[model samples]
Target: MSKSITLDQPDQRNLLDRMAQGTIGKPVNRLEGPDKVSGVATYAAEFSAPGAANGVLVTSTISKGEVALIDEASVMGMPGVLAVISDQRMIARPAQGGAGEAPVQQVKQIDYWGQPVAVVVAETFEQARDAAKRLKITYNADDMSDVVLNPEDADSWEEGPGTETVEQGALPQAMSEAAYSVDATYTTEGHNSAPMEPHAALAEWDGTKLTVHASLQMLNYNIDELADSMGLDAENVHLLSPYVGGGFGSKLGISPDVAAASVAAMQLGRPVRVVLSRQQVFQSVIRRTETTQRVRLAADADGRLQGFGHEAKVTNLPEEEFAEPVTQASAFLYPGQDRVLKVEMGRIHRMTAGSVRAPGEAVGMQALEAAMDELAEESGIGPVELRLRNIPERHPSDDVPYSSRRLAECLKAGAEAFGWDDKDRKPAQRREGEWWIGTGMATAARIHNLSKAEASVTLMEDGTAVVATDMTDIGTGTYTILGQIAGEMLGLEPSDVLVRLGDSDLARGPGSGGSWGAASSGSAVQIACEAIREELCDMLGCEDEDLTLKDGFAIHNNKRQSLPELLNGRSIEKLGKLKPGETEDDFAQASYGAFFTEVAVNAYTGETRIRRMSGAFGIGRVLNEKTAKSQCMGGMVWCIGSALMEDMMFDHRDGHLANCDLAEYHVPVNRDVPHLDVIMVEERDPAASPLQAKGVGELGICGGAGAICNAIYNACGVRLRSFPMTPDKLIDHLPEI
Candidate 1:
């Protein structure tokens, strides 16, 4: 019988805590850490096969046009060049994670810049690159390709995914009646995710069967999409992705390299490999869209918000139908009845905009919290106090009670830890040795999304356990946590639980995106382990409470039974899946937190440095102390980058990026980061899952950038409406100290 669980009510014991194995919540080092550091782990491009061909993808030079001419004869005869394929089958658009509409595969015309135009295959990677450069290609450029977003283009704008009136309750009237209000507009520059691993795919075909080793997050979803892209049955495709360097959100779907390599291998009847250069990864991969937001807040004398309006404009390709869901957290982040939330998507030819990191709230909150700081100033109220006053008793928009919310607690705890009262209230008040010191804080909230996931656990004759799932560990410490879950359930150490992941043959997981990977997949693992425990209980003729499982032994009435003996000449395996329950629809479920940051600004140079950072996050349960802390710290560092460093620059003339490589597109290095402290606030939300756990991965990013941005303002008394408050922009705005 198949086992299943829908998290409706809270599990009384939550298995992990009740088991008390001293392993589930402990600080466990990654099981694969040694392999990763020692170079034994094989990534997608590292996999090798005999007689394999290397394929180089050729991207388009023009922003938008048709392939007017391309010389196949120019490169087909080159030494070691096997084939120069310009087939449309090699050109499929990227998938937008989950089960989004598959992109059009065969397009003779280009809609955006840097679209994959063709590919060249050769015996060696060097030969393929050499031949790809030799091919002569030209485009019949079109004039309509020049599309740019304008604030005045309101006449052409359409309502986003949700209607404007869905949550806007007499917002205009409330704004007019309020005693105090702050209305401001903020714009943010666009950026893209740069994982340590550039996308790569290795494909091998035997007869009609195909196997692809690719860097991917969702295995089953990718298998279906890859099979569809190749026009083959899903049964004929196998995707193997065991370890990934990092995904952020880039590897959540089918990348261009996967399709090109698969097509080349199928055609050549041998293994073919495709690896993207850093430039190609930046030019073709999805990006966090730039946004312009007009946030208006109206509050009473007591600093209680009366009205809220958040209208944002974001962009994507003219044909692609995905835009940044910029107002995702605005509907419920604070308490206000007369609320208005909207998103306007502009159809532009800039790099196709899609999910990068915390898609909606990362940029959205940067704009919202800045306005909040402005509101606090306008109302003559403290910043943290104003946020506290606006905390909602119920859902601000839907009128639903929260499943579990601790924003106020998080703020208070973080403030206490960060010395909110100790910091001087006056902006630019304290300066020493040409440095202006200041502190800032912001509220953090992110929607807790859950997807269906399945896993299988097998008990071996040697008393060891094995957990199998198709989830990829994108440096998020998934392998360690999965073992922790099984070990907690089976009464064994995490090391004794051999966890196999990133293979399509294993049970399908939700595939690690949207911060739902751990909660959803862990729930499935819990259900499978519970099912086996129940079977063992029945075989022992004892009730669940009557049995005790510990250290590879099951004891009832103090009579011990070896776990391997229970497996006794039988294939003891249980398959399980977890589904969304009634609580999701009944409540507004979200992870909540607060960020406090201290910064030192150069009095003369307008340069800013983050001095110290601290955050308190309420993500329900901390699965692993070390990994959870790492996730928060990584996100906080991302905040440092988003606030002052990272920006994706494009040529306004051609719509192509000028600084497409990492050498120019700056990310935060070790020197750019400072001291970071993370506090995981304890929460046990039955509504989250059987584990009573929510994700801590993206929570820090929701308002993390805003905290640092607000700090820069406090330090130099400059309210930057635009993002990446780079020193050049600050020099002109800074006060004459």
Candidate 2:
């Protein structure tokens, strides 16, 4: 049987709490951990097929132009070389995450410096790489002077084509009349997803059918993308992505490697494999848009906000619809009657800009919270107290009630836990030897989102259960959480629930993007288990609410029976579906949190070291504590990198990415990171999901960088309006000891 529900209204049943088997939110270890550690799991590039050849992509050397000639004869006679492919169906760029179709597929025209133009195939990986590098290619290059690399250059921008603007009142008037005000501009550099695994794919074509094992985040959408790119019907495609090393957001859609491998395999009548080099991954994959934001805040003497304004300029390729939504959370994050929020996208000849980790608020909140700190100083109030005074009761612009909120609780609890009172809050007032020590804090928020999802749950007569879906784990514990949800509802241990995932033949699931996979997919599993429970009730001749199930046994009105006895010789399988409805837009839904950090800055040199950090989050209900904490900790690590180290260096002269590998592009190492603490403030939000849970993967980084930035200011009395507060940007501005 199939069960379906569209969340038109809030579901207040809280059925998981009433379940007799207690495993939903338990801190159980990952079910796939042993396989992953033992090398028993297969990743995309690890799959083997008979007579498979290796393929390497050749990228354009010019920033802008069209391929004029490809001298295939130059590499045809090379040792171990098989063939060179320059097909018209080759994708120009990677599809944006969640984009249902492939990106424009005219590879002859190069839009960026490192756009892939051809693929070289050979019997071995080394021969393929060598032949690809030696494959002579010529381009009809555009004038270098015509390329627009700087997003803030007003003369070059194709302005406001995809701009988003919101206004409820006259922000200028309120700003002019306010007792205290702040207006500042902040700039952030582009960022990459930088997942541990580079993009890879193995494709095989058997006459009419095409099968691909690829590193992808959203298979339900990726199948359509791959099929559309190949000009084939969707039914002719099969995809398997059972294990993903990591995506962050880079693998959300089909990339060049997948397209190239598929084309190669179909042309040669054999299987082909393609794995992107690290530098290729950096230069060709999607990047987070660089932003230039102007934030304006108006407030009373008591630190109450009266007006708020956030205007930002972000960049993307010309004609591309995906623009970084830099002002996403500013509309309702704080209380202000007069508000203006705008995002103006500039068309540039850089790499395609799309979601990284937390697309909108990752960089947006860094500037917003810094401006809020300035507002606190201007209003002569403490930072935490100022924030407490400005929590909006409803959406400031939409006037919609919040489905659930814990911003206040998070701030209060985090402050208490981090010892907010036992600090010298004045800038440059505390010093130890040659280092200045200080503490700071900021609020975190990310918009809640949901998507259509479906999963199947089967209760076997052998007293075990199975859950199947197309959702990819991406190292986020999807395998464990789904197993836990099924085990809780069906009166079985998590160990006894077999979770099969990452195959397109299974029930389609909402893929892991925007942090909605667990809730959306888990809700489907929950609904399927609910259907099984109703069947068990029929067998016991009792109502669902009156039955108690635990330890593989069902009890109804004091009558207990083992599940194997109840099922006899048959197994029950049910498919459940979840779709978003009116409730998605009827209320303002978002995950809320707070971050606190302490830092030490060298008085002589501009070096800064984090001393300690803590974050408290309310993501509705946590499905698993261990995984949730790990995600938060990982996001906090991103916070450290974004605030001080990570930057994608793009040369404006030719739109070339200067730092195209991890060696030059820095991330926090173990030595750079300090001891960390995470607090999960659990709540029940019926409107969020059937599990009463919201997404938490991206929330930990929403405004976390601002806390580190603010702490730097408190330590050294230097305030930087740029991302990556490198020592050079701070040393000259530091106070004289």
Q: Pick the candidate with the highest TM-score.
A: 2
Over all chains combined, what TM-score does candidate 2 have? 0.98
What C-alpha lDDT does candidate 2 achieve relative to the native structure?
Answer: 0.89
Question: Can you give the lDDT of residue 528 in candidate 1?
Answer: 93
Model 2 residue runs over 4 Å out of place are 92-102, 154-163, 422-424
Whole-model Cα lDDT of every candidate shown, in order: 0.83, 0.89
- TM-score against truth, every candidate: 0.97, 0.98
- Extract clashing residue pairs from model 2: none
| lDDT tens digits by residue: candidate 1, 3-48 | 9987666565767776746787789999999999999999999999
Q: For candidate 1, what is the lDDT?
A: 0.83
